[model samples]
Target chain A: MKKIKLKVPATVANLVCGFDILGMAVHDPYDEMEFRLLETPEIIIKHIDAFGLPEEPSGNVAGIVLLKIQEYFNLKNGFEVIIRKHIKPGSGLGSSAASAAGAAFGANVLLGNKLSKEEMIYFAMFGEELASGVRHADNIAPCIYGGITLVKSTHPIDIVSLNSPDLFVTAVHPQVEVKTSDARQILKKNITLKSAVEQWGNIAGLVAGIQKNDFPLIGRSLNDVIIEPIRSILIPKFDEIKAKSLQLGALGGGISGSGPSIFMLSEQKETAEKIAEMMKSVYTEIEIESFVYVSKINPSGIQIVEEV
Target chain B: MKKIKLKVPATVANLVCGFDILGMAVHDPYDEMEFRLLETPEIIIKHIDAFGLPEEPSGNVAGIVLLKIQEYFNLKNGFEVIIRKHIKPGSGLGSSAASAAGAAFGANVLLGNKLSKEEMIYFAMFGEELASGVRHADNIAPCIYGGITLVKSTHPIDIVSLNSPDLFVTAVHPQVEVKTSDARQILKKNITLKSAVEQWGNIAGLVAGIQKNDFPLIGRSLNDVIIEPIRSILIPKFDEIKAKSLQLGALGGGISGSGPSIFMLSEQKETAEKIAEMMKSVYTEIEIESFVYVSKINPSGIQIVEEV
Candidate 1:
């Protein structure tokens, strides 16, 4: 089998009120992939040391995804794969989604494009389900297509591409890990009717804001009462970082996903970099080491870097 | 207060997946009013017929609404009022909202245009809060100013008037009573996460439908998974009415508010009337006496019919 290389961008899910429903892709943070065609009818995966992936392809996140797709198509091609990770894992920046989506995208291209974008999202979600124990496309859809993407529904993965201009995104990954399982476990099974009303109002407003290109409305709508309150407790100085980011001229920012990282959206590139610096300062004051990424909205998801 | 005549249209709240947020007014089944100037300094009320209204002006639904406005603005004028009920009281057709909004509109004219539409709605909602034990403006806003309205936030009554064309509405009121409290009590405290996602998807589609004036999309969006399931059980032959209405070319219909009434929307006025007849026939087959009304969208809400 021959080798192939692919690149997948980092993504952010749960964009404020869009909890479990919306996601977007970032340009700077990415993961690299190497795929090799094999002689036998078996798939094998190897992590290129940087990604810290599991050895067996079937056990590895990206490898299991490829195996499921191959099984679905009953393909007999054997392959060896390697992944090089740049996006930090557990940063709430969709590092796992980048790997899973990148693998699925690369494999589908290698298989002569048998699936549509919607089909790719469906297949990619199987990889997400493997990682999180539940099928979710909020992160995968955006990682696949980039920019503002709405997982309008999960049953069929109705991905609606929103008209979001290329804006700067500032993200801070603190030296902490908040497991998605632990973060999800803390959410109340039944939200109060009061909170549900507020959440839906914000969700509607956020959708309108994005469509109308109203930044302040977007900032105001980027508020979550149900999940963030419970999840923010897992990340230290979450409130301080958010406050400093806003103080530094960010429209608004919050926990990226189930996170120890925080991200902010800014209309200008300078504001995004400034917000990133402010976030770093706040984390330093709290005695926590952090990595900052200043990027733009990625309109394309996974792409071929070079031919095999 | 000089004698004045006003009419307020009936409103439908919780339009399908909107739950507590969306409402609209129809031209038929409205409440009539005759306001009179009083010599006495105290408010007085009289019921011309068996409308089951309070005799005391301050205690009557309409009178209470006016009194609140008077108190808020420190007005000393007294008024005599009489209301003619046309919309049935317990058919979930916003009967209370009609009376409250009608009184507020009438009094605003009597006081020489002292309040804005926003203020009038705020006063009218106070009357509704007395009846429902909660403040909601979905019905009241439409009763004041018609067309498709979204009660984006209820605390301050942020009303967003959506761009919608004149829609034909067919409504059927089954001769029965379903207490709002009983209907509300039947809903599940916790819904599956899956249902919530579907609910929001429908809402997004519904909003787009209203904005785009797409009748088919509107009909498709008129699906309720949260409130209607529980509330419709209290409406006899509810399923048959919905089925027949759809079969008769009505776009879609569901239980209006907390119900003994069901309503459907159609693109043509003739079809609306046809749907209404179909509903009436279905109720007759079930041996349940019912009343049907076919009307178009009410663009302007409560208005002065005659001035002294």
Candidate 2:
């Protein structure tokens, strides 16, 4: 094996009532990983971009995942990994997941496609656990499989691929840091039984809405009663952005994953772009700098962009 | 209007993980209510069967609903209601819901059809609250509309009719009682975050499965971690009955509403009958007598058995 280049898409998890359970892939933002075979006895990692990644193999998210994969397969040859960061870190767009998933996927392809896609997802999730302190497959599965993905069960890595039509997603990443640990800590340990029932009902409806391509039903079902109420307080102007996006005929929108960013779904590209502009203007009025990405739903997960 | 007779089918609520939320209608095991237009300005109530129902207008479930409806419309004409109870009470089969919905629906038709279906459901749910001490529309909506029903929001009573295909249902009503209030009291106010996520995933799958008529997916999605674990203990031989029914080719089975009665579902009628026999045998070994009802999915809710 000589060299391999891989592209991994960003993911958004916990779409409304689907707390810690649902996720989907986006197209515009992605991360790139390059793998080179080395004759040296030990593994080495080099960061080519200023994402503030670690230089050593053990500390880096991608490097740690690669070490696990090699140990699992008992590989003797060493490899040098280089990560080129494209998606910004801590934007609630799954930056670390892309890195971990991209590294595992790139290594699998360079090593004669040794592991299956599911196996690669498991390995990438292992890497994500080190970064986030929890082995969640919601972000990693969508980053690997693309489109709208449901994490049915995490332990055995059971994933269900949903049928999503050609839809556009508009995301606005505000330049504010809300740590995942802090965001998670604010959530209440106990929820009202009534709210729990309502959440599950909406989740069921959202799943059916996605499968049927019923946009209105999807919009009606994209509601959160438990997690969003607490987590949205972390994002500035979150309620206003969500209300304005719905008012603009963008179907539904909410805080992406843990926040500092918000996303909305629209049926047309023009509407999606309009939503992006609307979100940008709201953040601008608040005097907060933000970056907007208008992209279509990516059906393809991790793929080889180039080879040497 | 001279006289009319209406029959409303039995309903099963809280389909596993969908506790206090989801419900479905079945074909057999229904309650019959007959209404006669009285020439006088006084309402009369009569219970002709041995289902242990109160005959007084205030204490009777159907008569109380009729009184509320009369108060809402402020009508001078009176009605004579006769309820023929076929579905046994204390069976966790929504038997009370059938009588309440049937009376409301029958009176609505008898009084020149003054209310819409949605309004009728609202009035019927009030009757359910009178019996259960909580205003819930899970059983009333399915009894009124038939098929699988989702009560999206109950404040103004918004109901979403789900598309559920022909499912074979086999139910065993054991000679035991499990109070609705007792079954509800045993549930923990706070659930584990992990179980909550799993429950939502299964609910999403169950919604998709019903929409697509995917039996395998429906079978897999019928798992419940929140309510069933505590409620199932109230029913004797519940675990063995569920296991035997599944082994006999049931897609899934659980306590219909509370306990003492177990229900199983299959794709074919023959398999449903077999599951019913298996469930019966399980209860018979414990010296408990049970009655089995094998029925198909009912699409039409309350129907006129005989018109004026």
Candidate 3:
């Protein structure tokens, strides 16, 4: 292909008790990318939306992934990638993952789909490592594979995309940033064995709920006894947003990733819409510009927007 | 009915990463109980097996469960319960849960099946409390509900029986005692958050594996980063047994509940039997009398042998 355009979905990671293990994709507020083959042996990147993201091939998230793919595949051809950023950066909505995954996915299409999805994730993780100094794929896996994904092991990078339930998601980003590093530092290195047992039970229940499509069970299992208690402090009015959303018939939700954004799930579209409205109230009260999305889980993580 | 006879299967608790939450029942080894209605306002208990277990209604595990049921149902009529213990005590095979579950199950049949399985578990937990000084129901839930049970919550006692796969189980009781209290005392009160994350991932994967009936997934997901690391030390030749079981085509296995007994799961009956033979070799080399059982998961937790 001479040129390819890709739409990459936003992902919410650290799903309650599934810290660093689970993530889910949402359809709305995605990142779009355009890639074109160039005649010169040079990689170029540009951001259509102004977010002050690094555009240098060595420093940019998407550029880094593209360079990794090119180097790993021994591709001498040059490429130019333009990104249209919609999922806000540092919103804890997997903005970096979208860029990273889009770069690898689009580049793979040009490479005749030589790499597997897992390999693409392996390459994209360099972008995450560039941003966070950690090669974690909880967000990238779901962004690339779509729906719910579990990073079973990171060393061998075993990731499995789980069956998705037909449910609606509501996300609210309150125009604030909770630096991932600060959130990481706040958490205790150790947790009580009691809490860990309870947390694993919820994780198991949550997986069973998703597989069986038991929405109420999913709601009941959305508990994070370990991380939420510490990290929710980073999100403004976190309690109010969660309580209101749940009260409005949202199945359940918590701080998205490490916060500033909160997401909830509902079985019905109307309930999801209502939950979004309720979540927005917290940002409104705080007088912050917030972004709200009510959408179904995107089953296809990255799809071809247009072909050459 | 004037008399009710019940057989409650043996249960394996603390299923790898599902510590204090998951359990499964096996049909081969069980405890049988016969409960007869008497015209007095007292409860009588007798042990047909030579275990020297308490025959009093307050001290015996089965009698305690029967008393609790009678008190809850406000039944003035007395019950004479005869216990035939087959699952050896302190073998880490949930011998107490079998007795407790058998009592509650038998009494419920006499009460015209008024109690739901969950309620039966709630009452049976008292028997566990009487035996262990704790009200945990990891074993009780599976002994009462069969299949694979997850005690997701304990306060309100929310328990779910997951779908059972067509897998074979091999168990070995090495004729040694690993006190549950000792096994528990060795565990640290806290675990590193990193280990907990890995543990919860395995748990989520295990639940998914059982739901999807994916044997390889089940085998892959049977890791215990937290509990087994410490608890396996209590079992003799623990590492060798587990390594050999896996090498012999057993999907996965670990310390049954705490120690002394080990269990392995296999995709076929022949593999399960082979796993049992391999496990027996360890005890035979050490000159220990070990009992081996190769069986499928008991879909029905408790069944009535006869009714009068």
Backbone clashes in each candidate structure, one number apiece?
3, 0, 0
Q: Please, what are the lDDT tens digits per residue for candidate 3 over residues B229-263?
A: 88888888899999999998988889888868899
Model 2 chain A worst lDDT run, 10 consecutive residues: A38-47
Which parts of model 3 are misplaced by more than 4 Å?
none
Query: Per-residue lDDT for A37-128 in model 2, tens only?
Result: 77664677777777787768778788888889888978887788877787888899888889888888888887898888789888888778
In order, the Cα lDDT scores of the candidates are 0.79, 0.84, 0.88
Better of 1 and 2 by lDDT: 2
By the TM-score metric, which is better: model 1 or model 3?
A: 3
Tens digit per residue, CA lDDT, model 1, B225-262? 77787788888888877887788788887988778889
Chain B, candidate 1: TM?
0.95
Instruction: Go through the candidates in order and give each one's DockQ.
Output: 0.27, 0.53, 0.87
In model 3 chain A, which range of ten residues has the least summed lDDT? A277-286
Model 3 C-alpha lDDT per residue in residues A1-308, reported as the tens digit of each score: 89999888899998877899999999988998999987676899999998999899999999998888778767779889989999998898999999998998998898888989989999999999998888999889999899999898878878877888898999999987799999999999989998998898899889988888888889999998889989998888888888888888888989888877899998889999988877777678779989999899888888898998
Chain B TM (all candidates)? 0.95, 0.97, 0.98
| Candidate order, TM-score descending | 3, 2, 1
Per-model TM against the reference: 0.84, 0.89, 0.98
Q: TM-score of the A chain in candidate 1?
A: 0.95
Say which candidate scores most in lDDT: 3
Model 2 clash pairs are none
True contacts kept of each: 0.16, 0.59, 0.90
